[model samples]
Target chain A: MSVFVTVGTTKFDNLINTVTKYSAIKAFQDLGYNRLVLQTGAGKIQKELDQLEELDKFTVEHYDFKPSITEDIESASLVISHAGAGSILETLGAKKPLLVVINEDLMGNHQLELAYQLYRDQHLYYCECSTFVETLKSSDFTKLKPFPDKKPKLFVDYLDNLLGFK
Target chain B: MDSELGVIAVLIAVVVCLVPIFSIYFSVNRTCKTKNPNVTSTKRTKPASVMIIAGSGGHTKEILSLVSSLGSHYSPRFYVIANTDKMSQQKIEALEAEKIKISNKMEYSIHTIPRSREVRQSWLTTVLSTAYATLYSFPLVFRLKPEVILCNGPGTCIPLCMAGLVLKIFGRDLKIVYAESICRVETLSLSGKILYYVADSLLVQWPSLHQKYPGSTYIGRLV
Candidate 1:
């Protein structure tokens, strides 16, 4: 199986760089992930990825972006993503083991709040770029609780009652 | 004596303008307080007209998911998106197509308004653009006359909600519901902060937000 790493629509060079390191590749291999698929948005890491691919330790694939990463996310055994709510929810919706890497440079601490809340709920593991490797090595992906299912019915019923449809 | 009379004339004009403005404000507030949303009115045979505001990116995703959950009675959906956002239209169309497959009936229209602000835009320009958008929303809101407006956190929603308020002032029972984006855990977004005072029903996904803003209801994770 492969490990999918996505930075969503924004440029996140730190995440792309950290995961491309030999240690990260070895860690993926340790987890039995023989292929690494990287969705590197606007990060010029293809050259480094190619160089690592030549080592023949495991397969390395890289792309800039796609209209939808759902297919890739579904196929992968594990997903490493930026702390954007959209990507986090999509990965969680796909019911995959997700390791969210926060882009601390971005303004606002809401991303941290979302990641922390989910982490507290045992739904996902989150880390900064500095602790990427350690978190990967130490965290138990199997123990992660599946994110609660989307209950649109609650909202519909609420609206219907509020609007006097019920 | 002539200058004093001119000053008096100007004061009268100012008071005349201020009277209507203050009256409208109090009238809107009274309507907001007195309208009991919990009281179920007599059921109608016809579908209710709804206006859905789709913001960019995650806002659009969350709003659409909520829309998909709605029953057929809340139909003839009117969608408003920013002209600059190219992605939300396609997503809306896709969702509508999916709805048609299930029900074989589709009633929705999409409209675009000028974006109030772009990323990194100057505050001065943002003010002017927002005012322009607010003016643009009045006609759209008047034309649609939607009974209900559903919006999540987006800069675009503020102007539309204002328009809905205007309709309310004109004796129309337009209901505006604003759902704070789920990304906001502790604090509300800029749009959410503004809509807190205006929307008929303000919803927050996180309990902390609900506790912080007594006006907002704590609805569990919507998207």
Candidate 2:
């Protein structure tokens, strides 16, 4: 099983730090899946993405921060994010379930509005930064499926039909 | 004819009396708040020093369009990369003046680095211009050192602005905001979506763009 976590701004390193010590970074090493968090920040996160010489299960690949979400979403089994709305839709497009970690409460509560809206809309699942790893690492990603494209969600079609003639 | 002349004379008299008075009123109204640049806005936590970057023509115009409102909201510094269109150049210059004359607000900056025809057909030109644009904007962003940067899209904004996003990640306290344009009403531009992925906040003037980038927040129309 491969888990690709891309929370733009690579500070997911901070989130992972919050979850487990340098010790727990060991357990994932033994799991035998290509586990890694693509630090998505343009450059602002922590300094040393030191090798988890201890946890060999995940190969933490530090991808240069490219802001294109479409490119980021390509071929990922699970999408983990900072509850930014862009990630939500891209994950939906790829038909993958998302694990969102919100910085609203972690940083300044700016995300609470959007995160709450999505939560209420029942379109996504969110965890605060503090509990993100616990919630994310435990997700049954093997069974992950896109939230049903239920009820003829014709967003693009509706726009096309309205604007096509004009 | 005399009556008509008399009416015209009266209108002229009114205009003669009102012109300077209106100007004075406008001056006073604009200055009353601007003398203190930090007259905070409800948009963000504090009154941010903002840099709004855009390409030459429509993109530049659209970016300038927001300056007045943004200035009213923050200590806005307009940074424009002169797009090639003459109309864009003239209008942006004109708007820059208007921005200054009204509020006595003079925090405007303009830079024109040979607009690329900048997009390319061949991969080489694309890569070269992309590289050039990226290299070009690096110094501009560092020099301005704004707390927040807004991009009004087309070709010009992404280069300098995207680099700024990368800088912010490295611990620059810059907040990146992208205002996707109306031209994108039909197709959400790839640049806009990329901004959606990276921006601290993404804004769209139209509701459809908002729907397209459901991840974005819709701020009101720009101009």
Candidate 3:
């Protein structure tokens, strides 16, 4: 059950339909993967999800409410998330390398800012929300870079600020 | 009765004279207290209740690292409290609530002010939104009652830290610290120097800030 936590929002179909046949979902199905859990609400898709219904061979589980997904996140080695900054940080803290698909409408160009910041810092991989399929398929999980050898020093200053270290 | 009234007047005079002397003495005492002491007094020091404030950005990411490093001693809290719409707040909150591990020591809360993304004809919109944000965030700060407030920027820090400064003045002892990021990519950004004047401690990830704010400490890179 190689579960991919797909946020089952309506926009997912747009990204999925772009896959044609070579999507990561299709690839996992071909590889005899058992189940893929969609961590999202069901009624959000308005006739748009039928195309995605073609891949029903991969047992689909819908966490109808967002809260039910307290544990579906634990299923994947890689997290696919909207380019929300909070999501990116959570995925990193979970110690899983992420494939970040950004929200287009926050802080003008903030999703890009976060992705580039993490990508530049070697924390995670960033890609456009428009190209979700391409991003996930090409996501090189095993080759993800680790955090720096030593902690960043401003951390020491933070400690000094909080504790006033002598 | 005449003698008693004169005694009363004399007593009032003595109290008035002593009050100024006491005020000057306390003033001098406070001045001396701020100076670096070779040996500390036996005063029972209260631990600083630190609040790390940041928005949904790299600023938040770096603050998380410090929260971990500062570890057990700093009993801390978090505040997002930003300028965004309700929908944006839901998304950020959902992501944050998902990320925050419920802990005995770590308490998390967020405040969002409703604002339109549209810029034109929205000058009034921004001012009202900013006012709303400031108005709601006071109780959060009051309840937490942090002794030291550390801010990571982008409009998120302003309201809470302003409250923190007020706490400093009225509460008679609180410090405001600003975490300066290594990169200065955004000009007129909330990060570059927003709280420079008020910050008791200004920590920078990059050494360049050392030259920029010679008074500021360059603490190297943050996470």
What's the lDDT for all of these models?
0.82, 0.53, 0.52
DockQ scores for all the models shown? Answer: 0.47, 0.01, 0.13
Tens-place lDDT per residue, model 1, B12-108, is 4334433554476566554433353333567545567999999888889889999988887888999999999889999999999988887888789
* Tens-digit lDDT string for candidate 3 (A43-115): 3543444445645556655444563333565666556665554455456656766776554444354235546
State which candidate, 1 or 2, has the greater DockQ: 1
Write model 1 residue lDDT over A1-166, tens digit each, in one string.
Answer: 9999999888998998899888887888888888889999987776776776464668888999898999999999999999989899999999999999988796465656788789989999988888999999999999999999988888988888778777
Give interface RMSD for all predictions: 2.7, 18.7, 5.7
Name every residue pair that clashes in candidate 1. none
Evaluated on the second chain alone, the candidates' TM-scores are 0.81, 0.68, 0.61
Q: How much native contact recovery, as a fraction, does model 3 achieve? A: 0.22
The per-residue C-alpha lDDT of model 3 at residue B74 equals 52
Docking class of 3: incorrect
Q: Rank the candidates by TM-score, best first.
A: 1, 3, 2
Docking class of 1: acceptable
The residue-by-residue lDDT of candidate 3 on B16-84, one tens digit each, is 433553455456534323332212233324345577665544555556556555544454445454554
By summed lDDT, the worst window of 10 consecutive residues in model 2 chain A runs over: A157-166
Q: Across residues A54-138, which tens digit of lDDT does each residue of candidate 2 receive? A: 4544556555466365654665655666655445545765776666777643564323444555455465667876666466556
Best by TM-score: 1
Model 2 stretches astray by more than 4 angstroms = A1-166, B1-47, B83-86, B114-120
Q: Between prediction 1 and prediction 2, which has the larger TM-score?
A: 1
